[model samples]
Target: MKRSSPAQISPDFRRTRVVDQTGIEERAARFTKRSIKQSSKLQALYQVLNMIDLTTLEGKDTDQKVRQLCYKARHPHDELSGIPTVAAICVYPNFVRVAKKSLEGSGIKVASVATAFPSGQSTRAIKLADTRLAVSEGADEVDMVISRGKFHAGEYAFVFDEIAAIKEACGKARLKVILETGELGSFDKVRRASDIAMHAGADFIKTSTGKIQPAATMPVTLVMLEAIRDFYYQTGKQVGMKPAGGISKSKLALHYLVMLRETLGQDWMSNEWFRFGASSLANDVLMQIRKEKTGQYQSAAYFSVD
Candidate 1:
Protein backbone atom coordinates (compact mmCIF):
# COMPACT_ATOMS: atom_id res chain seq x y z
CA MET A 1 0.00 0.00 0.00
CA LYS A 2 1.15 3.53 -0.79
CA ARG A 3 0.28 6.49 1.36
CA SER A 4 -1.11 9.74 0.01
CA SER A 5 -3.03 12.60 1.54
CA PRO A 6 -6.58 13.37 0.42
CA ALA A 7 -5.36 16.13 -1.85
CA GLN A 8 -2.84 13.88 -3.58
CA ILE A 9 -5.42 11.17 -4.26
CA SER A 10 -6.63 10.93 -7.88
CA PRO A 11 -10.08 11.11 -9.38
CA ASP A 12 -10.22 7.32 -9.35
CA PHE A 13 -10.33 7.55 -5.56
CA ARG A 14 -13.11 10.11 -5.55
CA ARG A 15 -15.60 8.25 -7.67
CA THR A 16 -18.75 6.68 -6.17
CA ARG A 17 -22.09 5.80 -7.72
CA VAL A 18 -25.40 6.12 -5.86
CA VAL A 19 -27.68 3.78 -7.86
CA ASP A 20 -30.87 5.78 -7.40
CA GLN A 21 -29.98 9.10 -5.90
CA THR A 22 -33.07 10.73 -7.40
CA GLY A 23 -35.31 8.14 -5.80
CA ILE A 24 -33.49 8.63 -2.51
CA GLU A 25 -34.01 12.38 -2.71
CA GLU A 26 -37.72 11.96 -3.40
CA ARG A 27 -38.13 9.50 -0.54
CA ALA A 28 -36.28 11.84 1.82
CA ALA A 29 -38.62 14.68 0.95
CA ARG A 30 -41.70 12.52 1.44
CA PHE A 31 -40.46 11.19 4.78
CA THR A 32 -39.87 14.71 6.01
CA LYS A 33 -43.49 15.55 5.29
CA ARG A 34 -44.74 12.40 7.00
CA SER A 35 -42.43 12.83 10.00
CA ILE A 36 -43.94 16.23 10.61
CA LYS A 37 -47.37 14.67 10.99
CA GLN A 38 -46.33 12.45 13.92
CA SER A 39 -45.49 14.55 16.95
CA SER A 40 -43.90 11.63 18.86
CA LYS A 41 -41.81 10.76 15.84
CA LEU A 42 -40.59 14.33 15.67
CA GLN A 43 -39.69 14.20 19.37
CA ALA A 44 -37.78 10.93 19.04
CA LEU A 45 -35.85 12.27 16.08
CA TYR A 46 -35.01 15.33 18.13
CA GLN A 47 -33.51 13.06 20.79
CA VAL A 48 -30.85 11.97 18.31
CA LEU A 49 -29.16 15.27 19.02
CA ASN A 50 -28.23 13.80 22.41
CA MET A 51 -27.21 10.21 21.62
CA ILE A 52 -23.73 9.21 22.88
CA ASP A 53 -21.81 5.91 22.98
CA LEU A 54 -19.73 6.67 26.16
CA THR A 55 -16.93 4.30 25.23
CA THR A 56 -14.41 5.60 27.79
CA LEU A 57 -13.51 8.25 30.34
CA GLU A 58 -9.90 9.44 30.38
CA GLY A 59 -9.51 10.02 34.10
CA LYS A 60 -12.45 8.35 35.77
CA ASP A 61 -13.40 4.91 36.99
CA THR A 62 -16.42 4.43 34.72
CA ASP A 63 -17.58 1.05 36.02
CA GLN A 64 -19.89 2.22 38.80
CA LYS A 65 -21.12 5.07 36.61
CA VAL A 66 -21.70 2.73 33.69
CA ARG A 67 -23.77 0.55 35.93
CA GLN A 68 -25.83 3.55 36.90
CA LEU A 69 -26.32 4.47 33.25
CA CYS A 70 -27.59 1.01 32.43
CA TYR A 71 -29.92 1.23 35.38
CA LYS A 72 -31.16 4.63 34.25
CA ALA A 73 -31.95 3.41 30.77
CA ARG A 74 -33.86 0.52 32.24
CA HIS A 75 -35.79 2.89 34.48
CA PRO A 76 -36.15 6.01 32.38
CA HIS A 77 -39.81 6.14 33.29
CA ASP A 78 -38.85 6.79 36.90
CA GLU A 79 -36.77 9.90 36.23
CA LEU A 80 -38.57 11.10 33.14
CA SER A 81 -42.10 9.79 33.04
CA GLY A 82 -43.17 8.14 29.80
CA ILE A 83 -39.73 8.58 28.24
CA PRO A 84 -37.68 5.70 26.82
CA THR A 85 -33.92 5.29 27.09
CA VAL A 86 -31.41 5.92 24.35
CA ALA A 87 -31.15 3.34 21.55
CA ALA A 88 -28.28 1.14 22.79
CA ILE A 89 -25.34 0.67 25.11
CA CYS A 90 -21.84 0.61 23.57
CA VAL A 91 -18.74 -0.34 25.53
CA TYR A 92 -15.39 -2.08 25.50
CA PRO A 93 -15.18 -5.87 25.16
CA ASN A 94 -14.69 -6.52 28.87
CA PHE A 95 -17.68 -4.35 29.71
CA VAL A 96 -20.05 -6.13 27.33
CA ARG A 97 -20.85 -8.46 30.20
CA VAL A 98 -21.68 -5.43 32.34
CA ALA A 99 -23.92 -3.97 29.67
CA LYS A 100 -25.39 -7.39 29.11
CA LYS A 101 -26.00 -7.87 32.79
CA SER A 102 -27.37 -4.36 33.11
CA LEU A 103 -29.56 -4.55 30.04
CA GLU A 104 -30.51 -8.20 30.43
CA GLY A 105 -33.35 -9.00 28.05
CA SER A 106 -33.96 -5.29 27.53
CA GLY A 107 -34.84 -4.09 24.05
CA ILE A 108 -31.57 -2.17 23.90
CA LYS A 109 -28.72 -4.07 22.23
CA VAL A 110 -25.24 -4.56 23.67
CA ALA A 111 -22.48 -3.46 21.29
CA SER A 112 -18.80 -4.04 22.16
CA VAL A 113 -15.92 -2.20 20.59
CA ALA A 114 -13.32 -4.68 19.35
CA THR A 115 -10.43 -5.10 16.87
CA ALA A 116 -7.83 -3.19 18.85
CA PHE A 117 -10.02 -0.12 18.99
CA PRO A 118 -8.72 3.48 18.82
CA SER A 119 -5.36 2.51 17.27
CA GLY A 120 -6.33 -0.68 15.35
CA GLN A 121 -2.66 -1.66 15.21
CA SER A 122 -2.95 -5.20 16.48
CA THR A 123 -2.06 -8.26 14.43
CA ARG A 124 -4.76 -10.30 12.68
CA ALA A 125 -4.62 -12.97 15.36
CA ILE A 126 -5.18 -10.41 18.08
CA LYS A 127 -7.98 -8.65 16.25
CA LEU A 128 -9.86 -11.86 15.46
CA ALA A 129 -9.36 -13.09 18.98
CA ASP A 130 -10.75 -9.81 20.26
CA THR A 131 -13.86 -10.15 18.13
CA ARG A 132 -14.49 -13.72 19.21
CA LEU A 133 -14.00 -12.84 22.85
CA ALA A 134 -16.50 -10.00 22.74
CA VAL A 135 -19.21 -12.04 20.97
CA SER A 136 -18.79 -14.94 23.38
CA GLU A 137 -19.23 -12.50 26.24
CA GLY A 138 -22.83 -11.78 25.12
CA ALA A 139 -22.32 -8.78 22.91
CA ASP A 140 -25.22 -8.70 20.48
CA GLU A 141 -22.93 -6.82 18.12
CA VAL A 142 -19.27 -5.97 17.72
CA ASP A 143 -17.83 -2.64 16.48
CA MET A 144 -14.36 -3.13 14.98
CA VAL A 145 -12.09 -0.38 13.73
CA ILE A 146 -10.42 -0.81 10.35
CA SER A 147 -6.64 -0.91 10.05
CA ARG A 148 -5.98 2.76 9.40
CA GLY A 149 -2.37 2.14 8.39
CA LYS A 150 -3.40 -0.11 5.50
CA PHE A 151 -6.29 2.13 4.58
CA HIS A 152 -4.05 5.21 4.52
CA ALA A 153 -1.61 3.30 2.32
CA GLY A 154 -4.41 2.53 -0.18
CA GLU A 155 -4.29 -1.16 0.67
CA TYR A 156 -7.99 -1.58 0.33
CA ALA A 157 -7.74 -5.32 -0.09
CA PHE A 158 -5.82 -5.69 3.13
CA VAL A 159 -8.33 -3.53 4.91
CA PHE A 160 -11.19 -5.50 3.37
CA ASP A 161 -9.68 -8.83 4.31
CA GLU A 162 -9.21 -7.77 7.91
CA ILE A 163 -12.82 -6.63 8.19
CA ALA A 164 -14.04 -9.90 6.65
CA ALA A 165 -11.94 -11.92 9.04
CA ILE A 166 -13.37 -10.02 11.99
CA LYS A 167 -16.87 -10.49 10.66
CA GLU A 168 -16.34 -14.21 10.46
CA ALA A 169 -15.10 -14.16 14.01
CA CYS A 170 -18.35 -12.55 15.12
CA GLY A 171 -20.33 -15.73 14.28
CA LYS A 172 -24.00 -15.10 15.14
CA ALA A 173 -23.14 -11.63 16.34
CA ARG A 174 -23.50 -8.62 14.02
CA LEU A 175 -20.34 -6.79 12.98
CA LYS A 176 -19.98 -3.01 12.70
CA VAL A 177 -16.92 -1.85 10.78
CA ILE A 178 -15.79 1.56 12.02
CA LEU A 179 -13.98 3.59 9.36
CA GLU A 180 -12.70 6.15 11.90
CA THR A 181 -13.90 8.62 9.33
CA GLY A 182 -11.58 11.30 10.67
CA GLU A 183 -8.53 9.39 9.53
CA LEU A 184 -10.02 8.50 6.15
CA GLY A 185 -9.03 11.96 4.80
CA SER A 186 -11.95 12.81 2.50
CA PHE A 187 -15.51 12.03 1.53
CA ASP A 188 -14.10 9.85 -1.24
CA LYS A 189 -12.08 7.77 1.20
CA VAL A 190 -15.06 7.59 3.52
CA ARG A 191 -17.25 6.36 0.64
CA ARG A 192 -14.64 3.86 -0.45
CA ALA A 193 -14.29 2.59 3.10
CA SER A 194 -18.05 2.31 3.35
CA ASP A 195 -18.13 0.22 0.17
CA ILE A 196 -15.25 -1.93 1.31
CA ALA A 197 -16.81 -2.58 4.70
CA MET A 198 -20.26 -3.37 3.33
CA HIS A 199 -18.89 -5.69 0.66
CA ALA A 200 -16.64 -7.36 3.21
CA GLY A 201 -19.67 -8.38 5.30
CA ALA A 202 -20.38 -5.59 7.74
CA ASP A 203 -23.81 -5.75 9.34
CA PHE A 204 -23.34 -2.05 10.11
CA ILE A 205 -20.96 0.66 8.89
CA LYS A 206 -20.20 3.20 11.62
CA THR A 207 -18.53 6.62 11.46
CA SER A 208 -15.99 6.91 14.29
CA THR A 209 -14.69 5.52 17.62
CA GLY A 210 -15.50 8.65 19.64
CA LYS A 211 -11.88 8.55 20.75
CA ILE A 212 -10.62 10.64 17.85
CA GLN A 213 -10.83 14.41 17.56
CA PRO A 214 -12.69 14.61 14.26
CA ALA A 215 -15.41 12.24 15.33
CA ALA A 216 -18.66 11.54 13.55
CA THR A 217 -20.33 14.56 11.93
CA MET A 218 -23.49 15.02 9.89
CA PRO A 219 -21.90 15.53 6.47
CA VAL A 220 -19.65 12.48 6.82
CA THR A 221 -22.38 10.45 8.46
CA LEU A 222 -24.65 11.60 5.64
CA VAL A 223 -22.13 10.29 3.13
CA MET A 224 -21.81 6.97 4.92
CA LEU A 225 -25.57 6.56 5.19
CA GLU A 226 -25.86 7.31 1.47
CA ALA A 227 -23.32 4.61 0.76
CA ILE A 228 -25.36 2.24 2.90
CA ARG A 229 -28.51 3.06 0.92
CA ASP A 230 -26.64 2.48 -2.34
CA PHE A 231 -25.27 -0.85 -1.12
CA TYR A 232 -28.74 -1.99 -0.12
CA TYR A 233 -29.99 -1.17 -3.59
CA GLN A 234 -27.28 -3.31 -5.19
CA THR A 235 -27.19 -6.12 -2.62
CA GLY A 236 -30.75 -6.13 -1.30
CA LYS A 237 -29.37 -6.48 2.22
CA GLN A 238 -29.81 -3.53 4.53
CA VAL A 239 -26.79 -2.50 6.56
CA GLY A 240 -27.28 -0.55 9.78
CA MET A 241 -25.82 2.93 10.26
CA LYS A 242 -24.26 4.45 13.41
CA PRO A 243 -22.66 7.85 13.91
CA ALA A 244 -20.67 7.49 17.12
CA GLY A 245 -18.84 10.56 18.31
CA GLY A 246 -19.44 14.05 19.53
CA ILE A 247 -23.18 13.58 19.03
CA SER A 248 -24.34 14.72 22.45
CA LYS A 249 -27.44 16.75 21.74
CA SER A 250 -31.06 15.72 21.18
CA LYS A 251 -31.47 18.08 18.25
CA LEU A 252 -28.48 16.60 16.38
CA ALA A 253 -29.70 13.06 16.86
CA LEU A 254 -32.94 14.13 15.26
CA HIS A 255 -31.07 15.42 12.23
CA TYR A 256 -29.29 12.09 11.74
CA LEU A 257 -32.59 10.28 12.16
CA VAL A 258 -34.16 12.67 9.71
CA MET A 259 -31.30 11.97 7.34
CA LEU A 260 -31.65 8.24 7.77
CA ARG A 261 -35.41 8.30 7.46
CA GLU A 262 -35.10 10.46 4.39
CA THR A 263 -32.37 8.38 2.81
CA LEU A 264 -33.35 4.84 3.82
CA GLY A 265 -37.02 5.14 4.71
CA GLN A 266 -39.01 3.96 7.74
CA ASP A 267 -37.43 0.55 7.28
CA TRP A 268 -34.25 2.00 8.78
CA MET A 269 -35.88 3.99 11.56
CA SER A 270 -35.92 1.20 14.15
CA ASN A 271 -33.10 0.44 16.58
CA GLU A 272 -32.07 -2.45 14.35
CA TRP A 273 -31.00 -0.11 11.53
CA PHE A 274 -30.14 3.12 13.36
CA ARG A 275 -28.08 3.92 16.51
CA PHE A 276 -26.26 6.87 18.06
CA GLY A 277 -22.83 6.28 19.68
CA ALA A 278 -22.10 8.72 22.47
CA SER A 279 -22.11 8.52 26.25
CA SER A 280 -23.35 12.03 26.80
CA LEU A 281 -26.05 11.70 24.16
CA ALA A 282 -28.30 9.32 26.05
CA ASN A 283 -28.91 11.73 28.93
CA ASP A 284 -29.50 14.62 26.59
CA VAL A 285 -32.10 12.67 24.72
CA LEU A 286 -33.64 11.67 28.02
CA MET A 287 -33.70 15.27 29.14
CA GLN A 288 -35.44 16.39 26.01
CA ILE A 289 -37.89 13.53 26.19
CA ARG A 290 -38.68 14.55 29.74
CA LYS A 291 -39.30 18.10 28.63
CA GLU A 292 -41.60 16.91 25.89
CA LYS A 293 -43.61 14.88 28.36
CA THR A 294 -43.54 17.09 31.45
CA GLY A 295 -42.95 20.47 29.84
CA GLN A 296 -40.16 21.25 32.32
CA TYR A 297 -36.38 21.12 32.50
CA GLN A 298 -34.79 18.20 34.36
CA SER A 299 -31.65 18.04 36.46
CA ALA A 300 -28.67 16.71 34.45
CA ALA A 301 -26.84 15.26 37.46
CA TYR A 302 -29.53 12.65 37.92
CA PHE A 303 -28.55 11.19 34.51
CA SER A 304 -25.34 9.22 34.15
CA VAL A 305 -23.43 7.87 31.13
CA ASP A 306 -20.55 6.41 33.19
Candidate 2:
Protein backbone atom coordinates (compact mmCIF):
# COMPACT_ATOMS: atom_id res chain seq x y z
CA MET A 1 0.00 0.00 0.00
CA LYS A 2 1.14 3.55 -0.73
CA ARG A 3 1.81 5.22 2.61
CA SER A 4 0.69 8.74 3.42
CA SER A 5 3.25 11.52 3.02
CA PRO A 6 4.45 13.89 5.71
CA ALA A 7 2.29 16.66 4.28
CA GLN A 8 -0.80 14.56 4.83
CA ILE A 9 -0.12 14.29 8.56
CA SER A 10 -1.67 17.06 10.62
CA PRO A 11 -0.44 18.91 13.71
CA ASP A 12 -2.92 16.88 15.74
CA PHE A 13 -0.82 13.80 14.97
CA ARG A 14 2.14 15.33 16.77
CA ARG A 15 0.09 15.97 19.86
CA THR A 16 0.64 12.57 21.44
CA ARG A 17 -1.18 11.40 24.53
CA VAL A 18 -0.12 13.04 27.81
CA VAL A 19 2.74 10.73 28.71
CA ASP A 20 2.41 8.94 32.05
CA GLN A 21 5.99 9.46 33.27
CA THR A 22 5.62 7.59 36.59
CA GLY A 23 3.89 4.63 34.94
CA ILE A 24 6.50 4.58 32.17
CA GLU A 25 9.32 4.52 34.75
CA GLU A 26 7.72 1.65 36.60
CA ARG A 27 7.14 -0.37 33.40
CA ALA A 28 10.69 0.24 32.22
CA ALA A 29 11.98 -1.01 35.58
CA ARG A 30 9.93 -4.16 35.17
CA PHE A 31 11.59 -4.90 31.83
CA THR A 32 14.90 -5.22 33.67
CA LYS A 33 13.52 -7.53 36.33
CA ARG A 34 12.78 -10.35 33.90
CA SER A 35 15.52 -12.97 33.59
CA ILE A 36 16.49 -15.44 30.84
CA LYS A 37 17.80 -18.99 30.94
CA GLN A 38 21.56 -19.47 30.30
CA SER A 39 20.90 -21.29 27.01
CA SER A 40 18.62 -18.54 25.76
CA LYS A 41 21.14 -15.92 26.89
CA LEU A 42 23.73 -17.34 24.46
CA GLN A 43 21.34 -17.10 21.52
CA ALA A 44 20.33 -13.58 22.51
CA LEU A 45 24.00 -12.56 22.67
CA TYR A 46 24.55 -13.66 19.06
CA GLN A 47 21.41 -11.79 18.07
CA VAL A 48 22.74 -8.69 19.88
CA LEU A 49 26.07 -8.94 18.02
CA ASN A 50 24.30 -9.08 14.67
CA MET A 51 22.11 -6.06 15.43
CA ILE A 52 24.92 -3.73 16.49
CA ASP A 53 25.93 -0.70 14.46
CA LEU A 54 29.53 -0.90 15.60
CA THR A 55 30.27 2.80 15.70
CA THR A 56 33.10 5.38 15.77
CA LEU A 57 31.67 8.87 15.37
CA GLU A 58 34.05 11.57 16.59
CA GLY A 59 36.35 14.46 15.64
CA LYS A 60 39.31 12.12 16.10
CA ASP A 61 37.99 9.47 13.69
CA THR A 62 40.74 8.44 11.27
CA ASP A 63 40.98 6.23 8.19
CA GLN A 64 42.88 3.72 10.30
CA LYS A 65 40.26 3.85 13.01
CA VAL A 66 37.36 3.49 10.56
CA ARG A 67 39.03 0.58 8.83
CA GLN A 68 39.74 -1.07 12.17
CA LEU A 69 36.13 -0.58 13.19
CA CYS A 70 34.92 -2.05 9.90
CA TYR A 71 37.17 -5.04 10.37
CA LYS A 72 35.74 -5.52 13.83
CA ALA A 73 32.22 -5.36 12.42
CA ARG A 74 33.12 -8.04 9.91
CA HIS A 75 34.87 -10.31 12.37
CA PRO A 76 33.59 -9.59 15.86
CA HIS A 77 35.71 -12.28 17.53
CA ASP A 78 38.25 -14.38 15.68
CA GLU A 79 38.54 -16.85 18.57
CA LEU A 80 34.79 -17.40 18.85
CA SER A 81 32.97 -19.81 16.57
CA GLY A 82 29.59 -19.24 14.87
CA ILE A 83 29.55 -15.59 15.81
CA PRO A 84 27.69 -13.45 13.26
CA THR A 85 29.06 -10.15 12.00
CA VAL A 86 27.41 -6.92 13.17
CA ALA A 87 24.69 -5.12 11.22
CA ALA A 88 26.89 -2.19 10.14
CA ILE A 89 29.80 0.18 10.82
CA CYS A 90 28.74 3.74 11.64
CA VAL A 91 31.22 6.54 11.01
CA TYR A 92 31.59 10.18 10.09
CA PRO A 93 30.99 11.09 6.43
CA ASN A 94 34.70 11.63 5.80
CA PHE A 95 35.42 8.05 6.82
CA VAL A 96 32.59 6.51 4.82
CA ARG A 97 34.89 5.52 1.99
CA VAL A 98 37.29 3.75 4.34
CA ALA A 99 34.47 1.89 6.01
CA LYS A 100 32.91 0.99 2.68
CA LYS A 101 36.19 -0.35 1.33
CA SER A 102 36.99 -2.35 4.45
CA LEU A 103 33.48 -3.75 4.81
CA GLU A 104 33.16 -4.78 1.15
CA GLY A 105 31.51 -8.20 0.55
CA SER A 106 31.12 -8.74 4.29
CA GLY A 107 27.40 -7.86 4.13
CA ILE A 108 28.11 -5.20 6.77
CA LYS A 109 26.68 -1.83 5.82
CA VAL A 110 28.44 1.55 6.09
CA ALA A 111 26.39 4.15 7.96
CA SER A 112 27.25 7.86 8.13
CA VAL A 113 25.88 10.49 10.50
CA ALA A 114 25.00 13.66 8.60
CA THR A 115 22.73 16.69 9.15
CA ALA A 116 25.23 18.31 11.56
CA PHE A 117 25.26 15.19 13.74
CA PRO A 118 24.82 15.99 17.46
CA SER A 119 23.75 19.50 16.55
CA GLY A 120 21.47 20.18 13.58
CA GLN A 121 22.08 23.92 13.48
CA SER A 122 23.48 24.05 9.96
CA THR A 123 21.67 25.18 6.83
CA ARG A 124 19.58 22.74 4.79
CA ALA A 125 21.90 23.15 1.83
CA ILE A 126 24.90 22.25 3.95
CA LYS A 127 23.11 19.31 5.55
CA LEU A 128 21.94 17.99 2.18
CA ALA A 129 25.44 18.36 0.80
CA ASP A 130 26.74 16.45 3.86
CA THR A 131 24.25 13.63 3.22
CA ARG A 132 25.01 13.55 -0.51
CA LEU A 133 28.72 13.33 0.18
CA ALA A 134 28.19 10.34 2.45
CA VAL A 135 25.97 8.62 -0.13
CA SER A 136 28.58 9.37 -2.78
CA GLU A 137 31.13 7.73 -0.51
CA GLY A 138 28.98 4.54 -0.46
CA ALA A 139 27.16 4.89 2.82
CA ASP A 140 24.33 2.36 2.77
CA GLU A 141 22.57 4.31 5.51
CA VAL A 142 22.54 7.95 6.62
CA ASP A 143 21.80 8.91 10.23
CA MET A 144 20.61 12.50 10.35
CA VAL A 145 19.80 14.55 13.43
CA ILE A 146 16.47 16.36 13.74
CA SER A 147 16.66 20.12 14.29
CA ARG A 148 16.14 20.15 18.05
CA GLY A 149 16.38 23.94 18.20
CA LYS A 150 13.45 24.23 15.82
CA PHE A 151 11.48 21.51 17.60
CA HIS A 152 11.99 23.19 20.98
CA ALA A 153 11.15 26.62 19.58
CA GLY A 154 7.75 25.22 18.52
CA GLU A 155 8.87 25.13 14.93
CA TYR A 156 7.50 21.66 14.14
CA ALA A 157 7.01 22.50 10.48
CA PHE A 158 10.67 23.42 10.06
CA VAL A 159 11.81 20.27 11.84
CA PHE A 160 9.60 18.10 9.63
CA ASP A 161 10.75 19.86 6.47
CA GLU A 162 14.43 19.41 7.37
CA ILE A 163 14.07 15.65 7.87
CA ALA A 164 12.10 15.27 4.63
CA ALA A 165 14.78 17.21 2.78
CA ILE A 166 17.57 15.05 4.19
CA LYS A 167 15.61 11.90 3.31
CA GLU A 168 15.66 13.08 -0.28
CA ALA A 169 19.37 13.92 -0.06
CA CYS A 170 20.06 10.37 1.08
CA GLY A 171 19.05 9.12 -2.38
CA LYS A 172 19.00 5.30 -2.25
CA ALA A 173 20.55 5.20 1.23
CA ARG A 174 18.28 4.51 4.21
CA LEU A 175 17.64 7.47 6.53
CA LYS A 176 17.74 7.19 10.32
CA VAL A 177 16.57 10.42 11.98
CA ILE A 178 18.14 10.88 15.41
CA LEU A 179 15.69 12.56 17.82
CA GLU A 180 18.34 13.01 20.53
CA THR A 181 15.61 12.31 23.05
CA GLY A 182 17.72 13.42 25.99
CA GLU A 183 17.82 16.97 24.63
CA LEU A 184 14.10 17.04 23.82
CA GLY A 185 13.08 17.91 27.48
CA SER A 186 10.51 15.21 28.37
CA PHE A 187 8.88 11.98 27.24
CA ASP A 188 5.93 13.92 25.78
CA LYS A 189 8.35 15.94 23.66
CA VAL A 190 10.14 12.75 22.69
CA ARG A 191 6.85 11.26 21.41
CA ARG A 192 6.15 14.44 19.47
CA ALA A 193 9.58 14.32 17.83
CA SER A 194 9.24 10.63 17.01
CA ASP A 195 5.92 11.31 15.29
CA ILE A 196 7.49 14.12 13.28
CA ALA A 197 10.43 12.00 12.21
CA MET A 198 8.33 9.03 11.08
CA HIS A 199 5.81 11.11 9.16
CA ALA A 200 8.72 13.09 7.68
CA GLY A 201 9.79 9.79 6.03
CA ALA A 202 12.39 8.60 8.49
CA ASP A 203 13.20 4.94 7.79
CA PHE A 204 14.35 4.79 11.40
CA ILE A 205 13.79 7.10 14.37
CA LYS A 206 16.76 6.98 16.71
CA THR A 207 17.05 7.97 20.37
CA SER A 208 20.43 9.72 20.41
CA THR A 209 23.74 10.68 18.80
CA GLY A 210 25.65 9.09 21.67
CA LYS A 211 27.14 12.56 22.23
CA ILE A 212 24.51 13.68 24.73
CA GLN A 213 24.23 12.63 28.35
CA PRO A 214 21.39 10.27 29.32
CA ALA A 215 21.11 8.94 25.81
CA ALA A 216 18.82 5.95 25.14
CA THR A 217 17.44 5.43 28.62
CA MET A 218 14.85 2.65 28.78
CA PRO A 219 11.94 5.02 29.31
CA VAL A 220 12.92 7.22 26.38
CA THR A 221 13.31 4.22 24.11
CA LEU A 222 9.94 2.90 25.22
CA VAL A 223 8.32 6.23 24.34
CA MET A 224 9.88 6.20 20.86
CA LEU A 225 8.78 2.60 20.34
CA GLU A 226 5.26 3.58 21.24
CA ALA A 227 5.46 6.43 18.75
CA ILE A 228 6.60 4.07 16.04
CA ARG A 229 3.75 1.75 16.90
CA ASP A 230 1.17 4.51 16.59
CA PHE A 231 2.72 5.75 13.36
CA TYR A 232 2.57 2.27 11.88
CA TYR A 233 -1.06 1.91 12.82
CA GLN A 234 -1.96 5.28 11.34
CA THR A 235 0.10 5.05 8.14
CA GLY A 236 0.64 1.32 7.57
CA LYS A 237 4.38 1.88 7.31
CA GLN A 238 6.99 0.28 9.56
CA VAL A 239 9.70 2.61 10.79
CA GLY A 240 12.87 1.21 12.34
CA MET A 241 14.25 2.11 15.79
CA LYS A 242 17.77 2.60 17.13
CA PRO A 243 18.43 3.18 20.80
CA ALA A 244 21.96 4.43 20.79
CA GLY A 245 24.48 5.24 23.52
CA GLY A 246 24.91 4.11 27.17
CA ILE A 247 23.61 0.58 26.35
CA SER A 248 27.04 -0.93 27.04
CA LYS A 249 26.34 -4.00 29.16
CA SER A 250 25.08 -7.32 27.73
CA LYS A 251 22.30 -7.59 30.30
CA LEU A 252 21.08 -4.12 29.34
CA ALA A 253 21.14 -5.08 25.67
CA LEU A 254 19.06 -8.18 26.46
CA HIS A 255 16.60 -6.07 28.40
CA TYR A 256 16.29 -3.85 25.30
CA LEU A 257 15.56 -6.92 23.17
CA VAL A 258 12.97 -7.99 25.69
CA MET A 259 11.46 -4.55 25.45
CA LEU A 260 11.47 -4.84 21.66
CA ARG A 261 9.72 -8.19 21.81
CA GLU A 262 7.14 -7.05 24.33
CA THR A 263 6.32 -3.58 23.02
CA LEU A 264 6.39 -4.03 19.24
CA GLY A 265 6.27 -7.83 19.16
CA GLN A 266 8.81 -10.23 17.57
CA ASP A 267 8.22 -8.68 14.15
CA TRP A 268 10.28 -5.65 15.23
CA MET A 269 12.92 -7.89 16.82
CA SER A 270 15.23 -8.12 13.77
CA ASN A 271 18.13 -5.86 12.78
CA GLU A 272 16.01 -4.59 9.87
CA TRP A 273 13.67 -3.12 12.48
CA PHE A 274 16.01 -2.32 15.41
CA ARG A 275 19.65 -1.32 16.01
CA PHE A 276 22.03 -0.42 18.82
CA GLY A 277 24.41 2.46 18.21
CA ALA A 278 27.56 1.73 20.23
CA SER A 279 31.29 1.18 19.83
CA SER A 280 31.89 -1.01 22.90
CA LEU A 281 28.56 -2.84 23.06
CA ALA A 282 29.82 -5.50 20.67
CA ASN A 283 32.66 -6.41 23.03
CA ASP A 284 30.44 -6.52 26.09
CA VAL A 285 27.97 -8.83 24.35
CA LEU A 286 30.84 -10.97 23.10
CA MET A 287 32.28 -11.21 26.58
CA GLN A 288 28.96 -12.32 27.96
CA ILE A 289 28.62 -14.93 25.23
CA ARG A 290 32.11 -16.20 26.02
CA LYS A 291 31.27 -16.33 29.70
CA GLU A 292 28.21 -18.41 28.97
CA LYS A 293 30.23 -20.78 26.82
CA THR A 294 33.29 -21.25 29.04
CA GLY A 295 31.68 -20.68 32.44
CA GLN A 296 34.44 -18.08 33.08
CA TYR A 297 34.17 -14.33 33.05
CA GLN A 298 35.84 -12.68 30.07
CA SER A 299 37.78 -9.43 29.95
CA ALA A 300 37.46 -6.34 27.77
CA ALA A 301 41.17 -6.78 26.97
CA TYR A 302 40.38 -9.79 24.77
CA PHE A 303 37.84 -8.14 22.49
CA SER A 304 38.93 -5.86 19.64
CA VAL A 305 38.81 -2.20 20.70
CA ASP A 306 36.97 -0.37 17.93
Query: TM-score: which candidate is best?
Result: 2
TM-score result, candidate 1: 0.83
List ranges where model 2 is wrong by over 4 Å: 1-7
TM-score of each: 0.83, 0.96
Candidate 2 on 1-306: residue-level lDDT in tens? 435653454556455676899988889889998888699989999999899999888788788988888778888888978999999989989999888888888889889999888798889999999999999999999999998888988888898888889898888899999999889999999989988888788999999999999899999999898888877777778899999999999999999999989998888888999999998888899899889989998888887776
Candidate 2's error at 265, in angstroms?
0.6
**Tens digits of per-residue lDDT for model 1 on 89-167?**
7777887787788888767677788888878998999999888889999988899999988988978878888988998
CA lDDT, candidate 1, residue 181: 89
Off-target runs (Cα >4 Å) in candidate 1 are 1-62, 298-306
Task: Report the Cα lDDT for residue 267, model 1.
Answer: 86
lDDT of each: 0.74, 0.88
lDDT of 1 at 130: 89
